[model samples]
Target: MERLITYKLPKFGFPRLLAIIGCWAYLALPSQADISLTFGTYAADKPTETVRKYRPFLSFLEIELSKALGEAVSIKMVIAKEYEHSIDQLANGEVDFSRFGPASYVLATKKNPDVEIIAMESQKGQKRFKGVIAVHEESEINDLSELAGHSFAFGDELSTIGRYLSQALLLSAGISGADLQTYEFLGRHDRVGTAVGSERFTAGALKESTFKKLVKSGVPIRELTTFDNVTKPWLASSTLAPHVVEAMRHIMLEEANASAVKQIAKHGFLEGDDADYQLVRDAMEDSQSF
Candidate 1:
């Protein structure tokens, strides 16, 4: 038989007892109250520049979240190599939060129904933005109909304004990809604008902001037509804590100010619903036949 074992509590002197009590008290407290989160996105421009532009916004999120949650909050920004990569990260619950274009948000939800929309970006006080199909200033091709025989440049295959909506615009003109002499996905709005401005391609499509920026920089491009696009939607990973989601939603919807977050969504955010992207969904579905 195993020997019976018994132990007696250690007798503590005054100093030792105080130290022992203090150690027990420290161990009994919650280990950590700080909250750490990951924010994911795909770069629409140079990755370095994208990170630079977003760091401040991420810091603002941390500050606001901390204030709302009554804990130290930190958010690490993660920029994926491409759109689909970021979408996968969000849809797979690999990241705590992410911002996505309308088309990407739709694609993510299609991929993982559990993904949730937290808010929609509000630009200039409206939850709407613009995309443009542009051509060289002197190009005689004056309309979407005129793009039939010309080569074209497009932004990322997954970019909302760059690919789907722009392609839908072409389809509405009764033009199809087969009608174009050649077309390629250049993967960035600025690149599409540059390709069109340099006459490398007869035409291209990109966001209105990028088109305006390129034109202002003497890129010599002109918007042939403009199309309305819904603003981007912010998403939360399915596995994120409900309390954290609530905190994030509160900060984004009520506390965001220009001085703090003036990145792509300059005016902050508004409550978003999946139905808000119906137009983009239609465009995405329609463009699939192309």
Candidate 2:
């Protein structure tokens, strides 16, 4: 009879076998299994309040995105201490997406050209919003010129309305930073409003929406001047998969998501691009305070 030979494969330890199987299983899984989107925003109010306001909307977003993607899409919010920090997180891919003030978006684009504006906030069906310089209703300050030789508060140093645009307004009124008696950054629009209303600040700069909300809530502040309108943008890192970005854009534009969008923006959202915020970038370049 012809000679026959048999070969035996080496046996692996149980733990080793499990580890090898786990590696292969992980590698074999769909890319979505490893995907999670982190959204970042500069603190527009108290950090906890800001997170509270956006968490429900983010949950809604997660559900919608999961349905669209046919996978368990995870979403989380990161609250940055300031606008520049938010931009930094977006630029370095620490956050996959972000909501930005017009000026912050400009700064982020400068830091990372791959950052893209995917959508913009809208109010009362309008795509633009303005900033305001306000003082206690009883303060003697009447115009930007009157702010000279008086203490002033700005919401955040990198704020579009609270700094750059408001500075432009002051410059137009022929008052430069050197012209002010003293100025300080109060960090948030609510803080600026509260400080000005309490007469702690001679005047303050903040977004018009915050000013209106504060006034409606009996803050006793009045707008001294308003800045030119600027477009706020929702930005995404280019590192995100194209399909993921597209899904976000589509969901934001959907009529069904309007209410959810309103929790963050009074109006909703509109499709937008980098060009929409070029004016903000130009303004920053033109401002000395920036």
Give the TM-scores of the predictions, in the order they appear: 0.88, 0.86
Best-fitting candidate, measured by TM-score?
1
Top candidate, metric lDDT: 1
169-237: candidate 1 lDDT, tens digit per residue: 899999899999999999988999999988999999899988888889999999798999999888999
| Cα lDDT, all candidates | 0.88, 0.83
User: For candidate 2, what is the total of clashing residue pairs?
Assistant: 0
Error (Å) of candidate 1 at residue 167 is 0.8
Give the clashing pairs for model 2.
none
Deviating ranges (above 4 Å) for candidate 1: 1-33, 255-259
Cα lDDT tens digits for candidate 2, 118-176: 78887667767778889999987777788788888987888888787777777878888
Off by over 4 Å in 2: 1-34
lDDT of 2 at 65: 88
